[model samples]
Target chain A: MTNLMRGTELARDIVLRASEKAAGYTERTGRKPCLATVIVGDDPASVTYVRMKQNRSHKAGLESRHVALPEETTTGELVAKIRELSDDPEVHGILLQHPVPRHIDERAAFEAIAPHKDVDGVTMHSFAGMSFGHSEFVSCTPGGIIRLLDAYDVEITGKHAVVIGRSPILGKPAAMLLLARDATVTICHSKTAGLPEIVRTADIVVAAVGKPKFVQGDWIKPGAVVVDAGYNEGNVGDVDFDAVTDALITPVPGGVGPTTIAVLLEQTVDAAWRELDA
Target chain B: MTNLMRGTELARDIVLRASEKAAGYTERTGRKPCLATVIVGDDPASVTYVRMKQNRSHKAGLESRHVALPEETTTGELVAKIRELSDDPEVHGILLQHPVPRHIDERAAFEAIAPHKDVDGVTMHSFAGMSFGHSEFVSCTPGGIIRLLDAYDVEITGKHAVVIGRSPILGKPAAMLLLARDATVTICHSKTAGLPEIVRTADIVVAAVGKPKFVQGDWIKPGAVVVDAGYNEGNVGDVDFDAVTDALITPVPGGVGPTTIAVLLEQTVDAAWRELDA
Candidate 1:
């Protein structure tokens, strides 16, 4: 029997708690917890994603305010809008949809959001804090992955964790969080040589490469807990799910993707509580 | 016959060039390269280290301004003095001697040094920049170690590099630097499990555990390049030099220690040059 690492069920549990907290916060503050989502350009996928997130926030008893920008928006213009939201005490969290126009400096836009309100945790301040094991908002995807691990009661401390892929959002931050937990962390990327040898020794494998089924079953050690954070086109993942016979694995569609939104909402409520307290 | 990595010799070359550049900058700018040395209290080791560094700087034709505070100095007082040096045009670089006092917040003092004058690069700004592959002055000892690696032409790209130890100044920063070079980087600390197995698979091993002969010979893969960055008591190193019969290794007493001073001088000259050019 293939043991599945179920993310959807765990996320449902987290979201239910977040919704309760958000409702309590609204009762105390006399205003709903608010998330400001700023999306630039007219990419269809980005629009759909923003709409979906907004819908989820509403369902969770939190409010999302949308700020739409034209495709020709300049970097300065985008940063200005983000700064306004960052300074607005009424807005508890800020979410800037990715894939801003190629002309704009995306990093600068991300950095404009204040650290306290960066619930999405895309800014360098949050990244640095998380890397150093300090108390700060973690990147949503990695945060969700860690939550899943904790929910499953995976013993991370003193384990050999191999993280494949090095993207700033997923692989790199995930490794940092794991290292902070006392795990011996190894980060592999496109330039990494002897990838299979490294993968074969891991107690935990986090496959985050965007390519479909890039990590084979032979690469996994016996009884290792595998977390596939990849969700590629056609609903495929970075790890070959069918290849691993007895190990615990997270499936593609219901795995990390579903849990990310859960983490995002949870952090939003946290940010709201902090802001209200402050 | 065993191949030994000559870290002292390489460091000497760097120091010579650095001294020459310092001299040139003094001639052009009519001021010597000056490093402000801030010492919180009079710990015997700290006193000796400060004097040794000042003596080296003077021999290299750089001026050393000493600010020795009393043991009762508060964090704010120390920060004020560091800020004075940070704003002083005469000070090209600043080095606050570490291990201030049990009562004082060391990180607060580190953050006081301005990035432009942070020749030692102990600030969070430097660490963040290094992690993101940006051009910033690196932590001195780790920066010097990287220079040693480059001088030896040890291939870093696509290599399985294992780093033991996780101090902010040494192991952690070194791991980030190696990761920046496209190496598959693994960080093992005191809490790491199965360290021997991990080290056995590395193409390149950096031992900075601060324990004498902690890593044995059989743990090294054949033909792997080993860097011993540890300086333990009695002039012994982290790696057991006598254990590895054929691998290239850096000798403890003469290796990474000398390179530390070299990097400090080089960065001081670099800061002076930036001032002169500006």
Candidate 2:
């Protein structure tokens, strides 16, 4: 019997707890935990992502304020807007939709989000915290992946984990998180030699290379746990799911995606609690 | 034919270039590149290390400032003194001797060093930069390891590199630098399983576990390049040197140490240039 590590159940449970906190916070402060999301351009996919996040936030008893900017927005303008939200006491957390027009300094824009309010965990400070094993928050997808593993009680310590990507927000932070958990981590990217052979050594595999079905069935060891963090255009993942056998795996659409939004809401509530305490 | 990768000659050549830059900067700006060294209590080894750095800085046409605090100094007091040096216009770089008394919060003291003056690269900002592959400065020893690799013309891209140990300033940043160079990097710590088996897989190995002669001869493969970052008591490295054969190795005493100090001085001068420009 193949075990599917479905994020749906886990995400629902996490969101339920977040909602309770949100309701309590609202009753006490007369305001719900708020996530201010900033987006540039009308990239159809990004638009859909933002809409889904906002809808989920509303359903979780949280308030999400959306800021939409034109395709021609400059880096300075975007940074100023994010900084304004960061300084606003009403805004508990901040999320900036990435891939901002290609011309804008995306890192500079990400850096503008205050560390405390960086619900999306895109800032360098958040990345450092994630790497160092101590921080107020973590990057959403990576954070969710760890929670997913813990919920399943998969062993991480002393296991060989292969992370196949080097993206600043995704692959890099995921590797760091695995390392922090006492797993021996090898980071493999496009430049890596003998890719399939390297994946064969992994007791745990995380496919985050952004390619649909990039990981072949033969690449993984039997009885290994696989976390497919890539969600491609065809509702497929980086792993060739149908060909994979004898392993626990997370499906693409209902796997990492829902848990990502769940973590965003959870962290937003956590941030509001800290802010209220202060 | 075993090739011994040495840091002594390369470090000397680097110091020569830095001395010229130091002279030019001093002639133009009327201020020598200055490194401020801070120490708490009088641990014999720590004192020797700090004094050596000061002597090297003076010989390289740089000014050296020393701050010695009592054993009873609190974290706040250490941070205050370091902050004073950080804010000083004359101090271009800051170095805090590590292993600060067990009672003190060392990370707090390290964080107090301003990013611009963090020549030793002990701050979170530098760690982020090292991970992200863009920053004006990097942790000194890790920076030196990369230079040593470059000088020897060792192939990094598409190679398997294993880093043993995960100290923030040494092993962790060394792994990041190797990853930045496009090497498939594995990080192994005390918690890792099957140690000798993992060491056999590396095309390049960095031993930074702070143990004397921990790695044995049979643990490494022939033609592998080993960079010993360990400088344990009695001047022994983590790798058992005499027992190894058919591999390029760096000697314990004359290997990583010189290059580490060279990178510190070079970055100090580079920081001075930026300060003078400003």
Native-referenced TM-scores of chain A, all candidate models: 0.96, 0.98
For candidate 2 chain B, which ten residues in a row score worst on lDDT? B1-10
Scored by lDDT, model 2 comes in at 0.93
Task: Please provide, for model 1 over B111-170, each residue's C-alpha lDDT reduced to its tens digit, 9 standing for 90 to 100.
Answer: 899988988878866776677777878888889788888988989999989999987678
Indicate which candidate wins on DockQ.
2
Tens digit per residue, CA lDDT, model 1, A92-209: 8999998789999988899899999999888777877787788889989899888888988999999999999887678888988999999999999999888898899899999989
RMSD in order of candidates = 2.4, 0.9
Q: Best candidate per lDDT, number?
A: 2
Clashing pairs in 2: none
- Model 1 misplaced stretches (Cα beyond 4 Å): B272-278
lDDT value, residue B24 of candidate 2:
97
DockQ values for all predictions? 0.71, 0.90
Clash list (residue pairs), candidate 1: none
Q: Which portions of model 2 miss their true places by more than 4 Å?
A: none
lDDT (10s digit) by residue, model 2, range B95-207: 99998999999989999999999999888888988999986598999999999999999999999999999988999999999999999999999999998999999999999
